[model samples]
Target: MMTQLLKVVPEPQAILRAWMPFKSVVGVTSVRTADDYVQARATVDALVDEIRADEDHPLADVLDYLGEQVKRYEDVHFTIPEAQPREVLRFLMEQHDLKQEDLADCAPQSRISDILNGKRAISKDIAKKLARRFNVHADLFL
Candidate 1:
C-alpha cells in the first residue's frame, strides 16, 4: 500500500474579497507603471509621516512594503551616481540660491569657499549648522 499526500489551497473568491478592500485602501498591490509607482510613493510618504521613528507602529510594515516597491521601480528606472560631500553641499547651495556669504551662520565666508573649492572638509560643528539651516540630516554634509 502507498500513502497519498494531501494538498491545501486557499479559496480564490475569499482571497479576492479580502484583497479588493486592501488594494483600494493601500493604493496598490504592486507598482506596475509610473502612475502606480507615484500612488505607491505617495502612500509610502503618508505612512512615514504617520510612523516616524516608531517601529512598533501598526503601519510600519506597510511602509516597508511600499518603500521596497518604490525602491524596485527606482532601481529599474533611475541611476543615481554617488556624490561627494562637497558636491552634495554645492547642490544644496544651488538649490537654495545661496552664495558662500549666505552660509555665514554655518561658517565664515572663507571657510565656505574653501569647502566649495575642496580645500577644507566640513567639520561636525559645521555639518550640524548646515543641517539645521537646510532642514536636512548632517550625514549629507559629512
Candidate 2:
C-alpha cells in the first residue's frame, strides 16, 4: 500500500518545483508542494503520538527532525514584540494595582506621575527600586 501510494504521488523533486518560495525561505529545498508540508506535518504528529504512547520508543532522530521543521515554520510565521520601558512599567503598575500615590515609598508622587506619563525618565536608583518592587530586571527600565 505504501509503495502504491508513493508511486501515485509526485516525487519530492516535483513537489519542490511548486513550492520553491516556501522551500527557499525554510532552507528546505527538498520539500516540493503543499502536500509535502501536510505529509511532513502528519508524519511528525504520528511520531509524537507514538513517542507519547511508548516513552521507550527510539524516536530521538524523529523528534529532532520534527523540532527543526516546526521551528523553521514558526520562525517564518510567528513574531512577538519586545517589551519597552513604558510597557514594562505599565504592566507592573497594573499587576500590583498601584497608583502614583502608592509609589511614594519608591519616589515622590510627582516623580511617579511624570514617569508614568512619559514626562520624566527613570533614573538608575528608581529603576533599582522598581525592579525590587516588581521583581523584574532593572534593565527593563533602562
lDDT for each of the candidates? Answer: 0.78, 0.62
TM-score for candidate 2, please give it.
Answer: 0.42
Worst ten-residue run, lDDT, model 1?
A: 128-137
Instruction: Give model 1's TM-score versus the native structure.
Output: 0.54
- Candidate 1 residue 41 Cα shift, in angstroms, is 0.8
lDDT per residue for candidate 2 within 12-130, as digits (tens), equals 99888867875454343332455545555555545554554343568746555655664465346533237667667877677447777866656888988888788988999888766
RMSD of each: 9.6, 17.3
Best by TM-score: 1
Query: Residue 101 in model 2: shift from native, Å?
Result: 1.0
